[model samples]
Target chain A: MPFSISLTVNGVSRNVELDDPRVTLLDLLRERLDLPGTKKGCDRGQCGACTVLVDGRRVNSCLALALSHDGAEITTIEGVAQGDELHPVQAAFIAHDAFQCGFCTPGQIMSAIGLINEGQAGDDPERIREAMSGNLCRCAAYVGIVDAVIEAQKRLADAGRREAA
Target chain B: MKTFDYVRPATIAEAVAASAAPGAAYLASGTNLLDLMKVGAARPDRLIDITHIAGLDHIDWLADGGVRIGALVRNADLAHDPAFVRAYPAVAEALLSGASAQLRNAATGGGNLLQRTRCAYFGDPASACNKREPGSGCDALGGENRLHAVLGWSPSCIAVHPSDFCVPLVALDAVAEIEGRAGRREIPLESLYCLPGDAPQRETVLEPGDLIVALRLADPTAFARHARYLKLRERTSYAFAVVSAAAALAMEEGRIRQARLALGGVAAKPWRARAAEDILAGARPGETIFRRAAEAALADARPSGDNAYKIELARRIIVRALTLAAAGTPQRLPALPASPFSSAPGARHAA
Candidate 1:
């Protein structure tokens, strides 16, 4: 039996017709939605390579079934940039060389954005590293990733302060 | 993942009724269940999607200063709840210590309690795991069983419960409010899990279709002042504990009025050290006494496999956890959360 689910993907509301219930959110995005930016690393929750914001909270899309997340607002890597202007976290990743092969970059950037939104790490480098531990980089880009997150968090905070003032 | 029919239940009654059928399982965040499904460990024909069920996502404060946490409350939300963190700091710390930030954000309170063991043999469908298949004959007994349980394990299974949250909850005497086909009932969280005896397949005391609606925690303000969760993991973060302990002390006039201690990653359930707690009550807090309590806590612990070192590690952790708890919980959680290095004076700065 096909299940119908409504989702807002990258600010665009989508009413998807699922042919099978076995389709995970990751598969739904990559296979059906024509969005391939979200990499499937482990295809399990262990590796956060398939991370995306479901209803503004970072979750492993691989483990989430599409039908279960009906009406969820999803933010994938493709939506991170505004036109050609890269998101702060994405630009920071480039500046800090946070990727070697660039496989884990999308997930790392999404997770960083989520962490900044979470507001738990503050400007603490160790906290940022700990918070970002979910996304693994086989290329050993952790040093660069941690630095990038710390710098991006500061920039976001500064931008917010300026907007408020 | 196998194809299954997903039913979104609007209420608790509907959820129970839908889950009453064989091969039906309630779906929460799917952090654990979905992973298991991918590995062919859990194959449910029908999924009762209970996430949409109303009135099950609250964190209510009772009049008696206790708390009633709905089953649907996400792990991150509960851990970061300011009032909850203040009252049950150890529980918050334990919650923060387990899994990654993403898993915590999606995982629910009830799902945490019901998470299956992380034993490699049980996760591998080809392996002979009595827990996965009754009477399959335990292969973990001789095959890379270093991480097997050190206590409360039977010949049928040596797997340990992998929940970090349950360690402190069991220690603090949390109660589970369950809704079954018959009616609602509450039980001590400590008794919720059964030791993997002859029937390793039957993990929890929950019958089929029994839904854990909420978990009630009585007032723990006395222990709040000196409560801490200390975890010794393979890494600084995002790893399960090799050995963990939750210690809370209620002190009176420089003497311990009461103590609660529990160990994790050592048994089929969160191993509450009632003997250690008994030993600490009315006694002055000191290194010698703490060591005695640690010894008492591991009195019956014998390694199920080659991981005899875990017994010693569990003992040391008990003492260190008690010491940290006696010293007092930090004004705020450490940057590294429950890691042993977090307790070091300049660890965060050095990092």
Candidate 2:
């Protein structure tokens, strides 16, 4: 009862075998592909600790079945960094000390990256708060997380200006 | 998750045939089904994967201003579409208020409507939930009854429907466009959700072989401009509501013309407050009338001992929601509902 799913993970073509009907993309990454950066916090959809990008939108991989994502282009936390360079949002998280214990960091970073890329995280502080509300930091360090997003947007704007110049 | 056979069909006809057998459930996004499977609540021996169905992801707007949202339409797409967010803000808001951005990205509009209850008894493997295991007896009646239903409660079941999107659909008079082996049927969104009577297991009216093709909605009227979804929850994000109200009102010169009132997190189905609507139809939109309407809405609310607070909270939510919808001054929700513990939006939840 196994089905073969053709999907691209982090820009690489993959033909993975899917069985069990309930085996999710998170399992395909953590167990099969050994890309464990997408942590399974709740396994249930309650926790956003397993967020990844399917077709450039953030999704809780823990609940996304592998077969459902066949031929989908998925991006995990591991794919955010290009070669040795860090994605601006990831670098900002570290610089701002946005997380503690760091269990939820990968999912947090993934969600933030998705928001920034989607252009939903705007200049308004309230909008930033609303956009990032999904990624929960149990440490309750939301102020830092908000600051990190603002800084990330500023850095992107600055980078855009330099490129234009 | 238990082992099961998986068949991914590329067409609705193929999917319908594949799911005709017993214990074969239609697989969409698996955001909800997978969770049920993981907890042993749902043990579908076979899952017919219909996500591969071609052209099922398209959202088509009819020339009559109606919207036809494919069952495969992701919540993220519904939430972000300019047409939906503008014309049907209540639907968009409901989609956005559900789960999280990440969860919504994977959860389809069909899956969101079909999500089971979040009652503690239903979710926990060891607890006795009649909805989870029919005739097992609902332990929620005595144990952890705070989050249980206040409306549409029977001895057999007390669980609430967990979809945030269905509330708005109920208010908007949406229809479920479904197809199956026999033929197709258009079920009113209101009739699509069944209240838990003796059998609490059957959440939707969908037949065994039926495949939900799309959630169809009528054209938005000027009344839509005043429509909004106001939810009372613990956190500002990714939370279910303690009591959520979706109100669509058409006001004519500071007075109520017609109003639709639907309540969530307080009933087995997305509970529509018809009596409240009757009270609001001709009355002037004021706090006093709103309170009276809220009273009418909750007049029949039967709350378990531990969850009686939900009765009051639910009444307040309906009042506040209707008031705002009447005035067309949408209230910015301070906190989303479904915060169990923590210094969140008032310890006023749980009923």
Q: Largest DockQ belongs to which candidate? A: 1
Can you write out model 2's per-residue Cα lDDT over B70-182, one digit (the tens) per residue? 99898888878887777787777777777777777778888777888888788887988778888888888877778778988888888888788999898888899889778
Interface RMSD of 1: 0.9
- Report model 2's interface C-alpha RMSD after superposition on the true interface residues: 2.5
lDDT of 1 at A159: 97
Instruction: List candidate 1 stretches off by more than 4 Å.
Output: B344-351
User: Candidate 2: lDDT over CA atoms?
Assistant: 0.81
Q: Kindly list the per-residue Cα lDDT of model 1 for residues A34-144, writing each as its tens digit.
A: 999999999888889999998899989998988899989999999989999999999999999999999988998899999999999998888888899899999999999
Which stretch of 10 consecutive residues in model 1 chain B shows the poorest summed lDDT?
Answer: B342-351
The per-prediction tally of clashing pairs is: 0, 3
- Backbone clash total for model 1 is 0
